[model samples]
Structure formats: structure tokens, C-alpha cells
Target: MKALTASSLTGLALLALTGCGESVSNRLMAPTDGPSATKAGTPIMRGLTSSAGVVPTAYDGNTSGDGSSSCSALGFGSTGTKVDGAYSQKVGGYQFTVSGSEKQYLAFAPSGTPTSTILAVIVKGGDAYDVYNYRNNPRTSDAGLTSPYNHGGNIPTISHYVVCYGPYTPPIFTKTLVGVMKEGATIGSMEDDLSWRDHPDLVIIPWGRTRWLDWQLSYTLPPGVTGIITENATTVCGSLGTFRLQCTFNENPATYPIYTWSGLSGQGAVLVMNDLGGGGAGSCGDHDYTNTATLALSNGTTLTASKTITVRVVCPTTP
Candidate 1:
């Protein structure tokens, strides 16, 4: 098998899997430095959207369910990068100071999360909070609105929360994790993401199977950025028998964090970073970085997705 490089997301020797009857040997063509392809490429998956109910589009600043409003019904339309579950990649969340004190409003789109009615979006400013959820319909699903959240007033150090019950096993959500925006502004000051993609957009998985899943992932890992996805994950002994972070590439090919996972089916991680400036590749300032990752499944299918995460750094000063 040939090696997979992250610099070129579109080109690579594909790993073709052959199936025999009801069972098959699942495998992913692994890179030269990491584990063998057969070890990292098994085909067993997981999911986070199993239970929920009908939800209204935009609620009127109330923790409890309030009235609703649709963009079409009110002469508005929805438009943007519309994908099913694209929001799944944004597990760590984003935070950025949008404007330099300009009077604006926030329009948000929580991708791939509208289908789960059990989910809720809450915003906190000063001492009060509000709720806004996605409207899973033909007219609205890309983004949602937490509008007039400031009333053109002092936009205090605001905070946003995306939470869901039942499936969350008591909701271990990152309270301040969110992707917020205004009419014309950035989502937040710090945007962290791991945009996971599956090929054949419409391909459905065969349920109740344990041998159909193996994965090989490649990331356009940036320099001077140290965070969850960039560093080696922690796995204590005896923590076996379930899905966990298998292994990450140790900068073998340069510019990419090639990795493999036992199962990323229903996993979420907080994106905490340390821009300590010891990497020697990064300077103090807002770094607008564009990264991408390609996930190779055991079924011989590959998926690629790109993301733009802008992180600002402040260098330490000495006497």
C-alpha cells in the first residue's frame, strides 16, 4: 500500500476493500510511519442523534420554549454551506471578538445539529440569558439567530452554550463553546474545528455490525498550534473494550497530523490550545489558518473537509 499525505487531500492511492458474503476483512491503507493499515482500518461506527422531538425555529429570548419565526414566513431566506452534520467537526467550539465596538446583530448557523430537538442553544450576557435553536426544515437549517442579544447596548463578555439531554449521558457540554456571528462579522476570535466528513454523502451505514468500520485520518495540522487534535491523546491502561483515541502521527510527513481512531462515531472533545510560542514557527498575532482532514474508511471510501480556524496569540514579555 502507498502512503497517504495530508498536503494533497484530493490525491492518494485508494484502499479498496473486498467483501465476501456476510463478513469481510476491513482495513485502511495506513501511512508508512504509523501502525499497519489493517490495524487502524476497521468498520464499526457510532452516532449521537438517536432521540429528539419537533422544535421551533427561532425562540424569543427565553430559556423555556417561546414563540417561533421562520425566515421564509417573514420574507427572509436561508443560504450558506448547507451540509448534513458539518457541525459535528466543531467539537472544540469557537470564540472571536467580532467588531471593534460596532452596533451589530448576530446570525448563527449550527450545522448538522438541527435534527436533534433535544439540543438547545443558550446565550449569556451581563446577568440574563436567551435560547435559540435550529429550524429543521426546507427553509432554515444552515444557521440560527440569537438576535438583538445586545440591544445595541454594551455587549458584555458574552457566552454561548450548545447542550443536549438523554444522549449526552447527563450533558457534559462545554458551556462557553459556540460559533457566533453578526450580520457581517467573524464567528468568534478563536475558531477550533475538526471537520469530519464521510464520502458518498448519501451512503447509509449497515446497523448492528461490529466488523464494518476501520478509519485512517489525515489533518492539515498547523504550526505553533498545540491543542487536542494536534497533540498525542491520553489513554490510561485498563481503559479498553470501547472507542478511544487510537494514535496520532508524530510529524512524520510534515504539515499533517495523520491519525487513526478506533471509533469517532459519537465523540466530542473540548478544543483547548496553548500558544506558548515555543514551536518557533508562530508569532504573536491573529493567525488565519486553513486546515483540512481526510478520513479513510475500511469500506475503501474516503472523505475530505477543510476548515478555517483563526487563533490570536500574545507573546510573553521579559525584562
Candidate 2:
């Protein structure tokens, strides 16, 4: 995949190849200096439809405070696993998809005001859990479990992530974005390029979060084809999507760019929505499918948005 900047995009030059954004690159991932205080207007979703049928339904609660704020996992999906108990006053959890084998620092910060102490856990499986404080990790309660791991230690990527604020009070508990930071790197990075590069002439982040939202994408498929497979041109046919709104990370990887989404469980980050079916055929005859999603953000609000996604399945030409 060729890593190009946004300014370099010509009349379909960058799109013709697998062009990624600043936060993404080949073997090289991007990170920022922690979270930036972004102005929250209707999340600027241009090009395609993603937010239900709305561009970005304004925050149901106050846009100022953390109320109804979304608990964003940059590369995660729309759904999440809700949890409650000892550490969690109000928990919002989602399984994370590790992109590669590189050890990363899991960063968490409140939306309205950044806080140091947030109750976060890496649930491996069963009753076993790796608990910690995001910034001052190393809160492993189990003697056998070595968590809050060293930057060079073996970390579990294909695991569940649950986040809540410590001292858990009303609201502002789950209002955070769980971001992955490679060791020595700063903070803040965009999710992988979710745009399906098969077609150079399309728009929309389609589905994803940049600034935790604002995105675009497009793809072509043979009519009626769906789920994990490739095309006649050997293009990987199905989209790897989220099982829940958690980013898929591959703990054990043999290649770079190991973090990807898919429809197949345990494959990549997400399970591609099954019904993104092609219409009949022909580029001019693109069918419209509205991709709608309602999310219960960690900040404690439910958001719903809708937009039309064009599904194009071109009829093959006789050679």
C-alpha cells in the first residue's frame, strides 16, 4: 500500500492506489501529542452516507459537557459490549482488533476534560483480566498475570476492552476514546484508511471515526456476492467489519498492516455488514443502500445517523 498525504490527491491519482492518511502508513503507524481539543460541530461527514440518514445528528445532550459523549475506539465498530461490576460504575466495552505485533500503549482520556484515572481492563478470556489505570498502568492484581505490560512485553491484542472513569460518578464515566499508542510515540492517531480502494472514483469515509467521526469509502462487487471472499480480479471481495464497535488488532502477526476489519469473526477488526449487496450490474446503475447506525457512546448518550451508500457491481465484459 502506497502511503500518500491528503494534499497529494490528484483527480483520482491517490485513489487509484491504496492511499492512506497521515496517521497510517506501511509498517509505520501515526500518533499525535495526545488528544486535541476539537470543535464539535455536526461531525463533517461529506461524500457518502454513514450516520443513519443524517450527516451527523448533533449531540442529543449538551455539546459542551461530556454528557452523551461517545466512547470512541477509533478503528472499532458501531456496537459495544456493556459491562458492570467492582471496577465499573458505568462500563462500555468492545473487543479490540490489534493491527500488528507491535506492543502499544493503550491511551484513554475524557472528552470534555482530560483525566488521568479511568478504569480500563483488557479481558483476555474467562475470569482472567488485565486491569490498570491508563496513564499509570501496572495495576495488575494477579501475581501470575503480568499486565500494564512493559512496552517491550507480550501484549494481548485480540481481547476485550472495557473503560470507565475511576471514582465513577454520574455521567462522564464512559465519555472517552480508547486509542492505541505505540511505545515512545506521542498520542492521537487516525484509524486505518477504511476507504475500499477498488474504485478510484468514489467518496465518503463511508464508515469510521476521524476526530472520532468524519470519514469516507467505496467499493465494487459482483452482483449478489457477499461475505469473506475475493473477486475475479483476485480482489479480496468481502469487507472485514466489526463484530462489535471494537478495533481488531492481531496480537500475533507475521506481516505489517496486520490490523484490518472483516466480516469473518476472529479474522480482522470488524465483520463486514452482510447486506451490502450489489444491485444488478453496470457502473452507471449503482444501487443505493443507506448505512445507518445508532451508538451508545461511553459518555452516556445514544446517537443515531443515516445516509445512503452506493453499491456498484459492474457487469463483466466478454474478452
Candidate 1 CA-lDDT value: 0.26
What digit string (tens of lDDT, one per residue) describes model 2 on residues 1-319? 9886666754254243223221111212112322221224211111111112211111111111121122333222222333322122223322222233332223322344233233333333121223322222212111121112111213323233344333322211111111211212245543422343443233222222211222221222221212232111111121212211212222224432222322322112221221122222132234443433333222323333344434444434459
Model 2: CA > 4 A from native: 1-271, 279-284, 298-300, 305-308, 315-319
Locate the minimum summed-lDDT window of 10 residues in model 1. Answer: 43-52
RMSD of 1: 29.4
> How well does each candidate superpose onto the true structure, as a TM-score?
0.19, 0.18
Task: Give lDDT: candidate 2, residue 167.
Answer: 32
> Model 2 RMSD to the real structure?
27.0
Candidate with the greatest TM-score versus the true structure:
1
Query: After superposition, which runs of candidate 1 have C-alpha atoms over 4 Å from their true positions?
Result: 1-257, 263-282, 316-319
In Å, residue 317's CA in model 2 sits off its true spot by 8.3
Per-candidate RMSD, Å? 29.4, 27.0
